[model samples]
Target chain A: MKKKLNLRKATPWLSAIGLFVLWELVVRIFNIPPYVLPTPSESIIVGWQFHEAIWMHAYHTLYTTLAGFAIAVVFGVVLGALVGSSRAIYDAANPLLVGFNSVPKVALVPVLVMWFGIGTVPAIITAFLISFFPIVVNVATGLATLEPELRDVLRSLGATRRDILIKVGFPRAMPYFFASLKVAITLAFVGSVISETVASNVGVGYLMLSASSKFNMPLVFAGLLVIAVMGIAMYEIFNVIERRSTKWANRGNPTN
Target chain B: MSNSFVELNDVKLRYSEGDDLALETTNMKIDKGEFIAVVGPSGCGKSSLLKLVSGLMPPSEGSVIVDGKEVAGPLKIVGMAFQNPTLLPWRTTLDNVLLPMEIVKPHRHRLRKYRAEYEERARKLLATVGLEGHEDKYPWELSGGMQQRASLCRSLIHEPELLMLDEPFGALDAFTREELWDILQNLWMIKPFTVILVTHDLREAAYLADTIYVMSKRPGKILVERENTLVRPRDQETTFTQPFTDLVHELRSHIRDVRES
Candidate 1:
């Protein structure tokens, strides 16, 4: 088990380094202009050189993404529960959810900017719109697909509605919730970046736009790197928290 | 002592407001401390009978009287185990066993005040089922047989007046199923609760039940009721003996007859 885990841990880093090495080799071999795609080392150096200013921009994007993600989570979970527990609500709202989900959230950026006037609000709204659907869809599906036999077992045990929700429904929903969170976190980052690109002047998306306008490709690459790092870091944090809380679920599965 | 601990009088059940009867005109009466096994072909409503007796479901057209009162809703005095262990995966084995206490009233009202006592009761129930050292383990951590044992422990933890088994050991391997039958026998021997076991296994019914009820398919109704005639503390050894196999075969033939009819 220990050896397997060690190998599992090593594989990702090995793949990442290999990819980086390939990128650098390809760039040097082709004599590609730095403006087009900076060399791996050049991007890393740029990332370091602009660390302070980049942190500020990244922080702005992070806050908007996080705030939007939080709001969406709250709305999605409550609405999901409402819809999930009722077939009528589910039927009524599911099509709307799909419709909204398919309406590329990026297209809403200009509309949001028009409504919210080029501030953090538009970025946050964009993130909320982009990231909300998965949480809703995942949670609603999870709640709907609850094992009937399990429900009967608890009901027979004299568990009230509240008890069933707290004990069975909620915990059962966690895996799905976390699954949605994984999708949501990445989408949250995308939403923030998209919004900043279109509207905001103070985020990693803005930094990328500013760098592109000036043709500072290294700075743009650095911004992209920071976004990637942030997305990965958020996902890891969520995975760790899920692991700690649901240690029971991790028992039999080696991969968990 | 009560003459009939449980009585189901002309019970009828349907899934919805206008649906045809799922179970029809079923009548049953069980004595105190009686271990009754209900066997039937699939969809025979053997489980539905247990549900009615346990007050998990109200008979649509009959009075389900337990301890002489019409069963209105889920009865607190009943414990149940299913084909699947259904142990909440998040809870430790011990905690899963104590779940009823935390949710069911009388115990729920006092659980926070007497938590240690409840924990001890849970531990004792687990130990009785040969799961002493595994109290802290999660459901997924345990093997199939072990999880089923824990599930049984959970059912019995609240010390209900009635114990309901709905094909509880059906999912287990034959050896493990036999082992559980004995474990269950010993537990009932120690403190006999009015047991209503639902199973597809005729052998299990013959072995565990003092009285075995057989039912027919779909809109299920009682086909036969046979008294075991076998003696108490019947162990695994008895299962292979001529007398027991004869009883099991008799029940099997009855089931076959019901299905054919």
Candidate 2:
């Protein structure tokens, strides 16, 4: 079992390395210009040379994304509870929220920039706007779909609505909340990057945009790599938290 | 006037205005500490009766009087268990059992002050249902039968005057169901409480109840009330007896008649 597990874990890295080698061979054989599509080795060299700059930019993206994600968590939970608790609030707000969610978040960046000015503020706002919807939807679904039998049990015990929500609904939503966090974290990064590319002077997104305009293809690829790594790291952190917090939800599933 | 512990006077329940009645003009008078079982076909509102008595829902037209007072809302004196164990998956067996105590009061207010005492009671209840060592185990770790047993402990934890069970053993296997029957009976024997059990199983009704009320198909009304004459301290041996079989047969026929009509 241990050997199999180790082999399973190694598979992805092996495929990734193989893909990079193939890309390098294709670039070298085609005699591709470094400005058009840099070889994997060239990209690595460029990334190493610009490590300090990349780290600084990555830090800005990370903090802005986190700031937005933190706001999303608080606002999502509150709005989710409100929507889930009452049919009136759900009916009233649902269509408006749907319409808002339908609008391309990229279009909203210019408007956000106009209102908040440039730099991290618009990026953070964009991140908060884009990532919060999934959390709200998942949390609301969790509370709304609470087992009727369980509700009846609590109701028969003379538990008030507040009592029921606090005791059962909130805990029931924890799994959904955690699940959404993993998805939302990725989206938060997308939001921050989009805003950064359009309006920001710093961050990995800005680094990529500036590099590409100057035909620094290798540096642009390096920026992409940094964003992907940060996104993966955040997602993994939430996944770990989710597993610990909602272990019971995953009990019957063999994958856990 | 008979001092009935729970009285349903011309009780009728309809989901909405002009909707078909779920229960129609049902009248029942349960004596204090009596174990009553209600059996009927699917969608016959056997559950509605339990809900009315437990004050989860008020009768549309008529009154549900428990302990000589009309029930206007959910009663704190009642504890309930359903077909699904409905134990919170996140909670341990002990914590699930203590859930009611944390909600219903004067116990709720006293929970913090008498935390140890409440926990002790919860532990004892778990032990009664053979869940002593499993107190700290989450619900999903336990089997279906074990979860149901813990559910029973939860219902009784608050020491409510009334217990409402809606097909509480319907999902368990035959052996597990029979085991729960004995456990439930022993609990009632030790501390008598008014029990209103709604089930489809005729044998279960005969084995556990003092009186079995058979209800008609949808828009349910009581079609028959058969008093169980089996000797006291009923057990697995009693279930095998001729009298027990006869009682079950009689209840089955009444259900059949209700179904046909």
Candidate 3:
């Protein structure tokens, strides 16, 4: 088991190192044009030169992503719990939720910008739109699929509805909630960047847009690298939280 | 008999708006501190009877009186365990057992002040079920039988006046099932709470119950009730004896009638 876990933990970093080495070797061997794909070293140099400026933009996108992600989690969980507990309510509202999900989240960016303007509000709203559905859908499924016998057991013990919700329903939904968080975190960053690209004066998305227009491929590559790093960092943080919250997975049984 | 602890008079139950009744005019009176087993065919309303007794549902056409009061809703003194043993995965075995104390009223009001006492009680209960060393372990860490044992401890931790077991050992292997039977027998022998066990296992019914009630299918009704003259603290050795097999075979023949009819 220890060996299995070590392999699982080591594989990602090993693959990443291998990919970087291959990229560097290919670039040096073929003398590929930097415009097509900047060599890893060239991109790193560019990334380091404007590190402070890149961080300022990175922080803006990060803040917006966080604010939107937090709002979506809170609202989605509460709403999901309500919808999940009642089949009638779920059937009534499912079409509306699905329809909202179908409409391109980017299309909402203009309307959000028009309403909230070109500040953090519009960007945060965009992130919320993109990240909210997964949480709501996953949590609703988790809440709905609780075993009937389990509910009967609680009922026989005279557990109140609130008691079941807090003690059984919410904790039962944690695995689903964490799975959704993995998807939501990446989408949140993407949504923030997209919003910034369309309607912002600051953020990594704006930096990428400006660099591309000026044909500064190296700077564009730098912005892309920063976005990648941020997404990975956020994913790692959430993965840690998921591991701690769900050590029950270690025993390979989810009886509850 | 007149001072029955639980009484159900002509109880009729149905599942849906227009379906036939699940239980039909079933009458029963249980004395306080008596242990009863209910056995029946598949799709019979044995479970429905338990539901009525626990006040999870009201009988369609009868009155259920527990301790001389009409059961308007769920009673706080009822504790239940089932075959699958659903303990919350997030909590330790000890926490899961103490869950009722966290919610049930008098205990709920005093839980914070009485945390240490509750823990001790939970520990003692787990120890009774042979789960003492596993207090800190989560439900997933334990095997199926171990988890069920922990679930039993959880059900009894609140010291409820009535204990309900809904096929609690149905999922276990024969050896484990018999082991739990002895454990359960010892627990009841010590406390003497009123017990209502719903099961398909005739031997289990014969081994554990003071009285066994048989029910018919669909719109289920009690067909017969037999008093077991078996002595207390029955061991595995007793199950091999003539009286035990005779009692089990009798219950089995009644279930055959229930199935065919």
Candidate 4:
């Protein structure tokens, strides 16, 4: 059991290093030229060579991603709370939200670019658009699942609807909000990259697009790795927060 | 009696139009600071009685009066606890106990200004229920019995005039249930309030209540009302006494008859 745990802990690093080795070997044995697919070493070396420009692009991506996520958080929670509280609003809004989510967010990037011009704003809007759905859904579920007994007890004490929402509804949704943040943050990255590739010129997605156009496959691969690392970093941050704020739910009675 | 604190006069109830009557025409008079228990077979409208008296539901046919006014909606003076221990999972035991104060009228207004006073009252109640040091712990972190203790505190903290309980100890183990009975009786002895506890346990009704009312099956009406002669501060020892056993037996026989018919 201890050996298994040790291996489990090592799996992520091992998988990462093994993937690099496999890519390097595949390139060497197949004698593939750098224009088509560069080895892991070549990608790293090229990525390091243009570190300053890559760094600038990465910074731009992070800034736009965070700005979009912040806006999504505010709008998603408010909309979710509104939808979750009343049966009428939930009924009216459910189908509309599901329909909007079904349409691939990438399809909207071109329209956004047309309306807002080719730049950071469109990318940020795309990130905001793709990420808010999960937040709304999770937050809604949190409020919807409140126990009937809890509602009855509060109402018996003359608690108004607003009092119930502030005291119980919002606080109970904290863990769910954080869970959605982790999911929404990663999706926000996907949105930003998609929009940047289609419209913007300053982000890592734009840099990768230019690199691909010029047959600089190594630099494009470097941009992909940077996004992966950033996504993992953001996920880890939210995971820690979710565990901290909602530890009570997990610590429930063992017999239960 | 003219001095009745809660008086139900020929009350009849149906959940909605065309539905079967949930409770039949019934009348009851409860004096101030009295403790009563309503026991019946499952689906016997015991809970419906609680709702009607607490003003959570209005009767279709008769007038229900409490504190000299007809109850139109939920009264501000009632505090309730349920079968399930519904302590807010996000809040600590102390905070959960302090919750009703943040909702009930006069207390709600004063709570923000006299935070320490309310906390002191909550702490005292929690300690009485043997939850002294456990106040900082969250509801889910505590055992079932502890959570119920916290729930009891939540109901009483507002100092409500009418306390309504719907099988509050129904989910607990036998040992925990008995332990809470003593704790609850202890709390009541110090400062009496009007209480209406609806339970399925015959012994619980026999042991805790000043009077016990038995109800028949659905579209229920009162079958019998037996005044408890069991004295105050009754403990586990009292449960084994001849009077207590006879009282439990009497209630059990009535419930068995109701269930069969």
Question: Each candidate's DockQ score against the native complex?
Answer: 0.56, 0.77, 0.52, 0.65
The DockQ for candidate 1, computed on C-alphas, is: 0.56
Order of models, best TM-score first: 2, 4, 1, 3
User: How big is the RMSD of model 1?
Assistant: 2.7
lDDT of 4 by residue, A1-256 (tens): 7798788889989999999999899999999998888998988999999999999999999999999999999999999999989889999999999999999998999899889999899999999999999999999988988887788788888888899889999888887888899999999999999999999889999999999999899999999999999999999999877888877765643321
Cα lDDT of model 3 overall? 0.88
Give the per-residue lDDT of model 1 (tens digit) for A30-128: 999999888989998988999999999999999999999999899989987877777899999989988988899889999988888997999998889
TM-score of 4: 0.92
TM-score of chain A of 3: 0.91
* Candidate 3's TM-score: 0.91
lDDT of 3 by residue, A1-256 (tens): 7797788789999998898889989988998888877788788898789889899999998999999999899988987998888899899989999999999888988999889889788899999889999999989998998888777767766788888888888888988999899899899998899999999999999989988898777889889888998899999898878878877754554321
The candidate scoring highest on lDDT is 2
Model 1 chain A: weakest 10-residue lDDT segment is A246-255
- Top TM-score: which candidate number? 2
Q: What is the interface RMSD of candidate 3, in Å?
A: 1.7
- Taking all chains together, each candidate's TM-score versus the true structure is 0.91, 0.96, 0.91, 0.92
Among the numbered candidates, top DockQ falls to: 2
Chain A TM-score for predicted structure 1: 0.94
Q: Give the TM-score of candidate 2.
A: 0.96
How many residue pairs clash in each candidate at the backbone level?
0, 0, 2, 0
Better of 2 and 3 by lDDT: 2
**What's the fnat for candidate 1, on a 0 to 1 scale?**
0.72
